[model samples]
Target chain A: MSAVASMRDSILRADTRLSKYHPLSRILFYDDFDEGVNGWCELVGNHAGNLDDIREIARDFRPPQLSSCTFFDIGTHGSIEGTYSLKLATRAVPNHAAIAIKRLTYMRRGLVQFETYFTFKAEQTFDRAALSGWDGNKAPSERQFGDFSFSNDICDGENGKRYMGLVRYLNTDVDGNLVQKWMHKTSVQPTTRMERQGVVPPNQDFHTVNPDDWEEIPGGNQPLCFNETASKVNWHYLKWIMDTSRRRMVELQCNDNVMDLSSIEVPVYDGHYHGLPNLLNFLLDVRTRTNVRNFLYLDSVLVSVDW
Target chain B: MLRRSFTAVLEKNSTFTSDFATEPYEAGWALEARWFVRILEISPGAGLTMTAQISPDGLFWCDEESGPFCLNEVGLASMPLRNFGQWLRLDARLSGKNPHVKVLIYLAVKG
Candidate 1:
């Protein structure tokens, strides 16, 4: 490395928080939940004045919360660095999803990287039937948790093509069976305009046109550390990089596993979108497969870019 | 630094004919909270009782110290809460013959 670049790297390595993340040349934003939500808000559907006009699937994504990671067993688990983390929580109802989004507009996009330390859990339940066959190590509550995803909505400019790139960690299937795989959507997400025009049916999964339009990534069957209980919280590090110039994902890193996602296809919109020039939005969502609330918590986030 | 404050829409244009509770919200960092209920439409002679509920965890809940607020017509009502532990929600019970109410609920918190 050059002398100037090496000096910059040494400075970043001295900082405790920034040292954990590998960022690009220029840092855009660093959001720590201890300082509040930091512009993370609930993702709602498009509606003109009337709330009833919103599609049923996109109406109630639920509000984002600043959670202390407290549980019934433990008083306060706290976050990785602070007492709070930005949290998205789904309802106890099956198929319910909660989404939180951060809106931004790119200045000059080349390579953008998003990094965070996150964790997921299913709400503690008192139902005795779910714990019938406890193996003493693997918690039954692990199956109650569903899946969580990180996605983005980006548009080049006015009359430019728009697309969403998403990656999901499938924790359990609808029947409470463990899938434990990383997957990507094979189809584009249906928009409200598409539903209004009858181009697509009302969606059950928000990420794709059909609920089954997802495929497992190659060599992606990796089980995360659920810590064998509902109350215990273990944070995992995730870093994803995307190339705006090429409109493709570069790679994804979670914990110690790094997956090359350069060959994966990102479904783009058929037509151009207006009123969204240089649109860049990041989203985090959690979905419950069973009748138990699922939660995704982000202790902190750092977005950097190579421009 | 100035205090941090936020307002969340718990229910938006939601119509209910039976008893229901809003989703649980975490506000452990907030020192005070308020609930605003806006009744957009209600059946004639239909009314509902709204109560503020608190939870130690997000799972189990109990009623707050403030008494329930009852509304019988189209209007707006609000309730203030303090000393609520961490989680907050609103439970509403519809009353009268085949009663139904369409309303909007907002929760504001500050710390």
Candidate 2:
């Protein structure tokens, strides 16, 4: 390595906050929830002046919160770094989802990387169903969490190609059976325009044209640490890299597991979209399988780019 | 630094014919909160009774100390709140025969 490059790496390693992240050439933004929710907002669907025009599936993605990660059992568990984290919470209704997005525009897209420490949980239920034979190590609440996803919206330019690159962790299927796998979407996201044109049917899953249009990634069956309780919170580190020039995923790293995503197909919209140019948006969402609220919490986020 | 504030649209053009509660929102860091309800359309002689609710955790909730706010006509109404615990939501009940109301709800918090 060059002397200048070595010196820069040494300086970055000395900084405690930046040490945990392996950033690209340029650090675009670093959001520490200790300060506040930095530009992260609830994702609302495109609508005219009338909110009634919003698609049913996209209407009620609940608002994001600055959570202290507190619980009735432990009071306040706090965040990894400070007192708060950005939280997206679903309602206690089956299939209900909550989403949060951070909007940005890229100057030049080569390679963009997003890194965060996040955790997921289902709300604590007082009443428990009787179990015939139970293992004490596994918590039932783990099966209540349907899924959580990371997705992006990128538009080349006006009247240009628009595509979404997404990855999801399915904790349980609709029947409340634990799946514990990572999956990628097979169909393009159904947009309001597509529905208006009668080209797509009403969607149950917000990420794809149909609820079943998802396939498990190869070797993606990995169970995360639920800590055997609903009240206990354990944060996991995730880092995803996407190649914008090629419009494809590079890799995904969760904790010690690294998966190559270069072969994953990223579905693009066939119809041209207007009014969006240089668009770059990052989204996070959580869904519940049973009538229990699910939550996704991010302690911090760092976005960098090699432009 | 200036005091941080946020305004969340809890409900937007939501029509309800029966009793319902807004989604729970976490505002433990905020010292003050306010609720804004905009009644877009309501059936003749129909009204809504809204009560501020607080939760120790996000799961269970109880009514706040302040009395409920009543909306009897089309327009906007706001309720200011203080000393509310970690979570906040609005519980609304429809009144008058076969009543239905379309409304927008906003929660503003500052710390």
Candidate 3:
């Protein structure tokens, strides 16, 4: 383990504290059918207005990929500011079969105002040393950042020799019981494939021939964590198998955004207008905030696709 | 297409009246801007009227220049004349304390 000693010789105390900040609110998933001008779009809950956390009942979780997932808890008859958005990059993924699969769950807020669906897929040769276990090798900051921002390094090294991703905005609605579901498909399974993946070491000596069996890599606080970040680090590899299965999963989310409009505190009112005289009091084409919204369930299985 | 119901004040602006001349002023520029009109609350009595005026050199006005185009209906309306310059001024002109009007018009070319 001499190679492991050199990297940790000088441990520079590092403080990577994440500051407290606010996340932007997203408005997706809703049925804007009736409620002409002003109305509430709340995805009401069942029973005594109490929300139940039944994960076991939520059979259709999203794809089992190890992508970062966030859950938001919202309220009824009020407003909420979400700190996340669905990050599914549909265009980049490849569905050799007609259908794709993913695991998903409702994190927060139900019966939302609207929702955008996206799909993503990626694959790497088990032999690509430039890649392979890079997810565990790269700084946690970069990996998490790739989930939302444009810092995706999935295919940075190789031009177009990879496939990995998620798609978003599958479905949406305004008011009613909201549910969150994962992507699923029922088709022929792809053949099995394997690879001889390896780990990079700071000190070749400590990483290579330290017959002590499991020799620790020489590094104080390395950004990349080998051994610990496995293919199934948290059911990540399960996603691989899930995608290859003929029967996939379905996921859904619900929010509380649709309003009852009548409940709105209308400060001033001159009764309802009909004819040409009704050309006042409208805030049209202006992006405005709403009362509530939520995510709904995956209505059905994706039986077909064009691309 | 979802639309909101609201109310706005439609006021009458400066009017004009002018006669046509042979020298002919540059009869260029058409009207084209579709400012959305909010219908907060309406009744059967009210009407939307667009006013315009005729100009000689655009400096002079006449009885042939100014008049009103009643929208006839009670909902939203779009008033844009191809030869908007044939008239001098109207209320549809986008200028005032709260210049919130959009008129979309296309004019013909002179041979």
Candidate 4:
């Protein structure tokens, strides 16, 4: 069997060796889609097709309050011979301000059918809101080009002032369909609408921007100190952490514990190397398929991030 | 302050020596003088000095002799500092029955 199939079977069976590496705070679709999973996903506008098919299988099960959560996946692409569609629902505390979290991972096996280079076909999406029912206007965060700056604009609740933010989400639906949805600011916060899922604020990302350090600027409708580049990247990265689970989350030894587990996966794909160079790829393909075919490894993980 | 390509390096090793160094200030790279040059590894009793030798292109020199030091007012030799920093070179010698046989030199420039 391919590595992908080997990995997926081990995970689905909750094999102790692999399961021990991921101590899930809760399992939303352990056996079948449970009412609790449906209830919480629905709170964020997720429906039958929105949660994984397994969630439909676990329509009545539930778990407990979370201190922390870890996840893993060993699967393949939709067409890859080793692809196994695995879905999990659990609490995720992403940062200091997180109230709750839900994470999902769709992984494809690394194939050396022709060469050893791991090929991954994966996609994930989710949403969030910083605050609620505020008069603050939003611009939908347009695509930032060069030298972007954020003006003084409050996006979260502070001093009882209301500000609602929305995170539009798009993900593969339960029936293998893809869906788009949106959630109110607090939808991803401390408690899910049904209070079944969320990071619980105990294991969350930063709750509030430091007023003194990130004061509002004189610019129109922006934060005191905001970089479109840094902000957007960080937001998406955090979003990725919030919605995706990896194959090995225990690798991170952070004392605080709020970390991105998907980061630990044995790469099936990546986009680094100071921006991938396409010119040498043809040569790489030839070499990778020849003497290097079965020997192809991820070579390295792009874990070092710049903020 | 608006600083460009700003960098900071406290000191790889604090062994003061005689060398003219320049770097950008991190605090006030915009308008305020934040890019400060410092001399490290100075003796307590050994007096510190930075003679500002100026040249049209900073090659041929003339001494303007004024620089800061991380030494006490009573003179560096009077009370040696294990590590030191200032916007000027620290001209001092390390001696006395102590074990400091190896010293490293470093420089940090605004790139």
Residue B8, model 1: lDDT of 91
**Top TM-score prediction, candidate number:** 1
For candidate 4, the TM-score is 0.18
Interface RMSD of 3: 30.0
Quality of candidate 1's docking, in CAPRI categories? high
Model 2 regions more than 4 Å off: A130-134
Interface DockQ of each model: 0.83, 0.80, 0.02, 0.00
Q: What lDDT would each prediction earn against the true structure? A: 0.92, 0.91, 0.20, 0.20
Docking class of 2: medium
lDDT of 2 by residue, B1-111 (tens): 989888889998989998999999999999999999999999988979999999988778999999899998999999999999899999999999999999999999999
Tens digits of lDDT, candidate 1, A27-88: 99999999988999999999999999999999898889999999988789999887999999
Error of 2 at A99 (Å): 1.2
CA shift of A179, model 3, Å: 4.3
A1-307: candidate 2 lDDT, tens digit per residue: 8999898899889988889889988999999987888999999999988788999999999789999998988889999987899999998999999999999988987899999999999988876463334498778788878999998999886787888888899999999999988899999999999999999998999999889999987767889998888889999999989898988988988888888889999999997888889899999999998899999999999999998
State the displacement of the C-alpha of residue A174, model 4, in Å, after optimal TM-score superposition: 48
Worst 10 residues of 3 chain A by lDDT: A280-289
**TM-score per model over all chains:** 0.98, 0.97, 0.15, 0.18
In candidate 3, what are the lDDT values of residues A185-223, reduced to their tens digit?
111111011001122222111111221222111121112
lDDT of 4 at A38: 19
Regions of candidate 4 where Cα sits further than 4 Å from its true position: A1-307, B1-9, B17-29, B34-41, B50-111
